[model samples]
Target: MTTMDLHSMTGAYALHALPDDERAAFERHLAGCASCAQEVAEFAATAARLALASSAPARPEMRERVLHRIGTVRQVPPSAAPLERVRRGAARGRGAARWALAACVAAATAFGGTAVWQYERAQDARHDAARAERQAEQVAGVLAAPDARTRSVRVAGGAGTLVVSAGRDRAVFMASGMPEPPSGKVYQLWFDDGGTMRSAGLMDPGRSTQTVLMRGAVDGASGVGITVEPAGGSRRPTTAPIALLGMPA
Candidate 1:
């Protein structure tokens, strides 16, 4: 497959949502392809960020309902060595049953929260299915761009890289990087269309390298930017870009 074709499919692959044929082909290629593997990982992380940005509509009393169910679920104990099991059986006698029950209860409680979180996320996904699919396709296309390639960019604190490619049949993000932000803040990306800056995506404070896959065609973007903003990013840039990467159409 061409670079562009690969870039376009990265998003779907990241989400494990690609059609069987395409997914199989990509995996076959990825096994022997270092560049494509890296590309897919970065794209998956970015897709995760976009998914986080979409606020979920709250479900009333959902937390309680989930916890209740979790408490009733069964749990499996970790396997013990034969000698260890024999020793425990002799020592605990009836107490072993109580320990097992306690372990089950604890496991259920711990997994309960996780299960609820997953359910809520599923609901949110269903709520934004169409929009998410469109955006995923757009982002995937950039990551899969034919002639697109990524290069390392040295930054003051850590590993930084730039992924530049094509999308919407044109040049995509000119330059992209991850820089540390203030407490309770994050770096955000933007696409400049005339005087307006539309949110491209958000950054994680812990990340050092950022992969930016442009959505829509980068046909007319005057520049790309990174700014520090509250978590979840902003509808508009709230600060000057810490890094500015531009491309002229």
Candidate 2:
């Protein structure tokens, strides 16, 4: 691979994500480049800290993901040719993008921004896997119903879609890039049961995309709607709806 390509592999290298060939190639690259070596060291230390922090109340999937991650990497063969190449690449003054990405990940770990946060989020997801699987099956049922139909929707920041199965009294909401609600507020879903709206659930803050099954019964409901409310969500919509989507009979 080219120098740029190899530089991009640094994160993967630190994470033990590279395969045998690429791992070997990168170690050769690493042996010569002090900056990359230093960056990798930071990555290793940061990951080690997170690993320690995430150690308690451990879940089996965590181990599974790690084992499945790299299948164990082999030691890199000895190399002696990074100094000259590092000097040349530095003189040209390029390839900062890759290092920036690596540094950002390390920094995020330090700030509790994403690296460990996302891993913990992943653990949360795993905890809900059974419920998610059941939801998936329910959504499948809605999609496969004889009367099922999908309709497109428009929201301020991005498009939305609704799949309705009146025969089954169920619906699914799918959207991407939905704008975040104003501070101290959240997006709430509702089942427009005739003229009466029933609380569904709150959309996750900062989540830009998702496909979710609307909670509660859909029977006799006109459709679904979204409204901004207090962060913990409102018993009923206190603000005007940002968007209203009607269901078909």
Candidate 3:
């Protein structure tokens, strides 16, 4: 690979996204490329610092959630050569405490630098996340809202045809054209997992077919479902499903 390609892959490499062939090539380059390896180290350290910026203000629940998410991703240890070098120097010293203090100072400095870098990255990540969420909500609003004169019910073409962009604490629905139900009954949305049913929202009949449908966050309907119920709606579907959609929780 060219030097430019190798340099560009540093971030992806740190994230471990490179394919086997690409990873082998990069590792081969890194073996002889001190500059590239150094750059990789810096990027990895910066990523670690970015993680620190997301650190909560010492709350138990927040800490638990953070740890849970962190547990899903593989942890990459920081380069230890600097610490090793310090330890060797400490070994040559007459007193362990003095060397230990020096080592602590070094660690503190490293952490401080990393924390600052991570704070900026965290801010940037937050901004990006907010922007993405806004765009998503706007799209959801458009899909859910039907020009103020109507309501919508999302009808997926098939299983896995719908994608709902929702946070863990929120429920969201993305759907397309669905036929209106028969008289004396309305289409009620539900979240069913092959067993019990939970109400999502009451989908109003559209003036015509082939329209968009969106639903706000609702309690109980963690999964998506549709069933025919009373005009006003039902707490749960009493009959079989008219349609259903689901996503992993």
User: Which candidate leads in TM-score?
Assistant: 2
Tens digits of per-residue lDDT for model 3, 224-247: 666778788887678777566545
Candidate 2 versus truth, CA RMSD in Å, comes to: 19.3
Position 229, candidate 3: lDDT? 84
The C-alpha TM-scores of every prediction are: 0.39, 0.48, 0.31
Best by lDDT: 2
Misplaced by over 4 Å in model 1 are: 1-144, 147-179, 215-219
User: Tens digit of lDDT per residue, candidate 1, span 1-249?
Assistant: 675686577556666666888877766656545455555656555554544424676697898898988999887665678768878787787687889978876765554544444334333334455454555576566667775655443333444444555444533333334446778898777777887887777765776654445544555667666678998788888777666655532
Arrange candidates by lDDT, descending: 2, 1, 3
Candidate 3: deviation at residue 40, Å? 62
- C-alpha displacement of 247 in model 2, angstroms? 0.9
- Candidate 2 per-residue C-alpha lDDT over 1-249 given as tens digits, one digit per residue, 9 for 90 to 100: 998887777567656667999988877776555456655656654665754434367798998898876777665653457767767788666568667867876765564543344334333434455466688899889878999888777876787888888888888888788888788988888988777779878887687798778887787777788888999998988988877888855
Task: Show the lowest summed lDDT stretch of 10 residues, model 3.
Answer: 145-154
lDDT of 2 at 141: 92
lDDT at 220 for candidate 3?
Answer: 39
- Off by more than 4 A, model 2: 1-127
